[model samples]
Target: MSDEPLRIVHCFRSPVGGIFRHVRDLAEAQTSAGHLVGIVCDSSTGGVHEDRLFEAIAPFLALGVTRTPMQRHIGFGDLAAARRTLGILHRMKADVLHGHGAKGGVYARLFGTSMRLGGRRVARLYSPHGGSLHYDPRTMTGRMFFALERMMERFGDGVLFVSDHERRTFINKIGEPRGRTTLVYNGLRDEEFVPVEAMQDAADFLYIGMMRDLKGPDLFIDALADTSRTTRLPVSAAMVGAGDDLPRYREQVRLLGLSDHVRFFDPMPARDAFRLARHVVVPSRAEAMPYIVLEALAATKPMIASMVGGIPEIFDEWRHGLVRPTVEQIAQKMREALDDPIQFAGLMPPAESLRARFSAGVMATAIERTYREALRRHS
Candidate 1:
């Protein structure tokens, strides 16, 4: 491998949620380390909130940001999208094609392989980010995706997993990866470690993330209702983030008569959302080391999160405190936290511990080393 800076291009589908966060962190960190980085993602997904995020990182993207229409599922449209993506990658002259999710992984490996055929020495890397791994292997959709994952392994030089559970799920569902694999936990920045103080009129709880079922926004609402009824007291919350199911969640809150207590807001910075509530609740049904958990912990904000995916790994010794993603369980935990805030706060991992384990600097270094290794092997 050359000592010169590597030109890296990250390809992902949605420029929202954790995948986007991961890419932004990597792009900034990599750029600081003297590497040139770029981003390629779907243009049709994010709104003003995501636009703001892109603007913050645009200056660091040496290869620049490229967006195009990308369909969420397999279709004839993929052929056109893939061609466009391949063209973009070729033009960027990326030394490493790093894909962030299922769709991105497919594009990175396939497009990177196509480039290789034309005598390009690009290292193809894929990070699942709990994308297709969320499917059930027993179902037809799951089997099909797993099969594709197994096949795609051959086209990539390496697989990067954000959590151990993500890697295990891939092996259990699709069998052992044919290429090299690395487990790199998602990380947080130094400024993110600064605790966010609640406003004088902050809500009782905060649910920040996509307003979709998988993330358990519905469960959070039901738990809030359950908590209020059981305690015979009003419980207020702020739900942030945008999703297709936003209307459904709003309807759910109204139907449950929580319209007065629950407020919906547009997607904003996590720290900004954190200050709107005294406590955070992550009731995700599944995850791959969600950045929200790390962010909340680093911010020194007390929180209760479901034990799923790589969350257990994040919790580590504190994993015993995690609850299952259920209305009853989430409600019970909510009540517990509210009833005895001190005891609940004690369950949180120390900020110093989180900072030591999950930092943007560490994450970027490990990933850069992995890229170099892949390039060396391919060379």
Candidate 2:
């Protein structure tokens, strides 16, 4: 390890979703290891919950935070935004610029490239947490994004993938990256490994991710209705997250006449939310090793998750834990969990194994090593 702590800056688009969680864990780990860290992300995306998270993590961000109006798509206006982002990064003089999602990755690699050209010492690293990989390459939009991904790779010093599935998808969609690539699964803190028993009035099901289509919140609501009908029992669900599409999902619940059965809340700490329901439901259509999976597993909470992204990888040989993303498939699992959550819970990996494989300490050390490698090659 170097004598001094490295200055690290993380850039991403929305301050929500899996990307945001991943950065929070990584930032805490890095800070505890005596590193200086900062965050640069979109100001308008997250809400009051995220504001509290920023407050809790403020001490770690010695280089300070930069929240700007960042757009989702690449457009003429992005040129100005890029300049603004570059200005923030330049002022920080970050030793490593690590980007979390597509927009953040683009900014990090491009800005780091400019810093290198100016004889500045910096390393550019990217972790694609299934941001751009959800695109269907057969479509025109996919082609455009994949092409942009290829160009972005040229600017990257080291490419990090959260799962083997994400890495394979990147190679298939964007071609083999010329830069170094590494696989680092998401991790959890030791305290998270303890089992979490539900509260006395825990809901029958819980959906605790971003309230958006990509995460399949709509499917969760549909399956809850289906489960109630099939089982002939009134089932309740707690949807504990916030996103731009939350209003739309609320309308969906209203139209489906599930207002009484399904209750909504803004985002809260994952551990606290875990106690609100008997079983967690992660019905995402796409993912790249979601931290929620790791969190739930570490907490020894029984779960029903969709078989997308790196979720299957988490189960390892116990792939029976996965269900399809469709309403029918999720409903099937929901019924089973309702009937016998104890048996269903047996399918989860042991806490010891999960703790061994997905420790935050291990993840931070491995990522810091990658940063050092990138800095060494920063010519």
Candidate 3:
């Protein structure tokens, strides 16, 4: 193997949420190491903010960004999507095709196989990121998706799981991966570790994530109401995000008569949203090493998050702050945080511990090692 810089392309459907954040961080780190990185994702996913993010990361991507209509479901559309993605990868001569989530995984693995058939070598990798893993195996759709997942494993050069729990889910649901896989944790930058001072009139709590039900935005609203009623305190919250389910959540807040108590904002930087509230709540119904958890913890902000996916992994020894993704549990936790901010803050692990475990530098180094190993095998 040579020490020359590698050309990398990340294929994923939507350029939003945690996956987008993960790719951006990885691209920056890889670029700093003199690697050529690029992104291929859905163009229809985001608004102005996403366009800005694309521009910010454009400097690192030698292949530039390739945006096409990559849908969320399995349909005839996938054939065309795969072709577009494959064409882009061939053009980039990508040494590594790293796919994020389900659609991205399908595109990357299939495209890698196509390249191999055309006498080109590429290391194909998939990171589940709680995509298809959220499906119930007993359902027909789940069965079909899992079966497809099994078929795709053959096309993969390897898998890059974000957490051990995700790897376990793959084993339990889709059977053991036929080849190789590794657990690579998501991470954050150095500046994020500093303590954040809440705005003078910040809300009592913050909900910063996609405004979808899977993320438990409704649960956040319900918990806020329950926390208000139980503690008899005028609890206030700021929920920041955008999604298809946003209108429904907005209606819910209005129906609950909390239009004022629960303020809403378009999706912004997590740090900015963190400043609008004293504490952050990640009420995700499911996940695979959510970046929000790492972001909030890195900001030295006290948080109450669901004990699902790799969230508990982040807590590690500090389990007091983790809770079930439900209204009652979150409401109770909210009551505690509201009752005594100082006490709740004391429950979180120290900033130094989190910084050591989840830094972007460590994450990038491990991933680059994985890429090198996969390339060797591909060669």
Q: Measure candidate 2: CA RMSD.
A: 1.3
Between 2 and 3, whose TM-score is larger? 3
Better of 2 and 3 by lDDT: 3
Candidate 3: tens digits of C-alpha lDDT, residues 324-363: 9989999999988888899999989787988888889999
Judging by TM-score, tell me the better candidate of 1 and 2. 1
What clash pairs does model 2 have? Answer: none
Off by over 4 Å in 2: none
In lDDT terms, how accurate is model 3? 0.89
Arranged by TM-score with the best first, the candidates are: 1, 3, 2
The CA lDDT at 287 in model 2 is 88
Q: By lDDT, highest first, what's the ranking? A: 1, 3, 2
Model 2, position 106: C-alpha lDDT score: 94
Give candidate 2's error at residue 107 in angstroms.
Answer: 0.6
Clashes of each: 0, 0, 0
